[model samples]
Target: METRDFELLIGRNIIEKYRADRHRPAVFALAGLEWDLLDEVWPPTYSPGGELFAGRIPFDRMSSFLEMGCGTGIMSVLAARAGVERVLGLDINPAAVRNTELNARRHAVADRVTARESDLYSAVGPDERFDGIYWNPPFLNAPEDSVDTSIWDETMFDPEYAKLRRFLAEGRELLTPRGKAYLWFGEALGNPALVADLAEETGYDLGVLAKTEMAEIPEALADAFPADLVGGDSEDGEDAAWHLHLLELRPRQA
Candidate 1:
């Protein structure tokens, strides 16, 4: 599929799903833990990315952690439960911040997990640092002139990759000397080349930690786009199901 067509189809599907399910609050279990998702907060039940990333976090290696764009504090709470000493979850959406707080308290990790409304690193203290930082960013490049009119829109779109650029640049300053940062990106749904370019430009070496296939596209979405376009062998002969990439970012070796 053409890039524009693919983006439009994905955007439409995201909006439709959000509209259909935004007001519903529910509890979901992932990796042996329960998370309470609030209305308007992105739900892990809809996308497996959060659970996937949370499971891969090296909690044993980190004393302090920061989770950017923490929708419902799933990873933050899990990290604390796994014995990370301190976990801070940040989100630009007020609803998400509150949802994270709710889940933190729900899991009895309220003392260890802190949620704040922040646009990337804006709310992070300059003198504070974390042993690990991670984000499942709004990776889609929204069409020009697009304005985020809703929290769902902010969750799904990042116009011109602006937020991503800042994330890579600013997040570096908040990491301890031995700390590492991770980004969970969907190669099929995001611009990977741009991600590489931004990582290099921001003085980081980007590498893959792990990856998994999405496996099945929703029947509704499959019908909207060409069958071959949505999922099939890629130009490199790799299955398109292998889309979600858990990427690792480290400071460039001097």
Candidate 2:
């Protein structure tokens, strides 16, 4: 499918799911823990991408961890449970920050996990650094005009990859000498070439750590998606499969 058509389909799926759920608060179970998802916070139950990415984190290798765009603090709490000494979760959405804090407390990891509002690294302390940092970013390249139309848009779209570029550029400064930045990206839905360009421009080497197949249309919005776009058994078929990649970014050697 054409990039524009694919983006439109993703936008439709996001809008339909948001409208159907109306941003209600609910409890969700992930990684055998109950997370209290607050209103207007992105719902992990709506998609398995976050949980799948969270499972890939190497908690045993890190003493301190940071999770960017932490919707419900699932990864932060899980990291603490996995024996990471400290975990910090940051989000641009205040609701998400609060939701993460709620889940941290809910899981009895409040002392070790902290959640705060941040637009990428804005809220991170200059003197502080993490052994591991990761983000499941807003990967879709939505049109500039469609941004900030709703809170849900913040979770789904990153127009022109402005935020993504900053994450790659500015994030390097906040990492420890041996630390690595991990990005959970939807390459099939987003512009992978632009990502590669940005990573190289920012002086980082990008490598794929792991990948998994996810449905192009989220399960909750599967029925709402246009049937015509759903591909079938033909040589020219375009199946509804998208790949989510866990990418490792290391600062380029001198």
TM-score for each model: 0.89, 0.88
Q: After aligning candidate 1 to the native by TM-score, how far in Å is the CA of 218 from where it should be?
A: 5.4
Give the C-alpha miss distance for residue 107 in model 1, angstroms. 1.5
Supply candidate 1's per-residue lDDT for 99. 89
Give per-residue CA lDDT, model 2, range 68-159, as digits (tens): 99988887888898888989999888999898888888888899998889877889886879988888888778777755656677777888
Worst 10 residues of 2 by lDDT: 232-241
Q: Model 2: which residue pairs collide?
A: none
Candidate 1 Cα errors over 4 Å, as ranges: 22-25, 218-239
Global CA lDDT of candidate 1, please?
A: 0.79
Best lDDT goes to which candidate?
A: 1
Please give, for residues 15-128, the per-residue lDDT of candidate 1 as tens digits. 676666544558878767777877777766666664566767678989999999999888888889889999999998898999899988988989999989987788988787
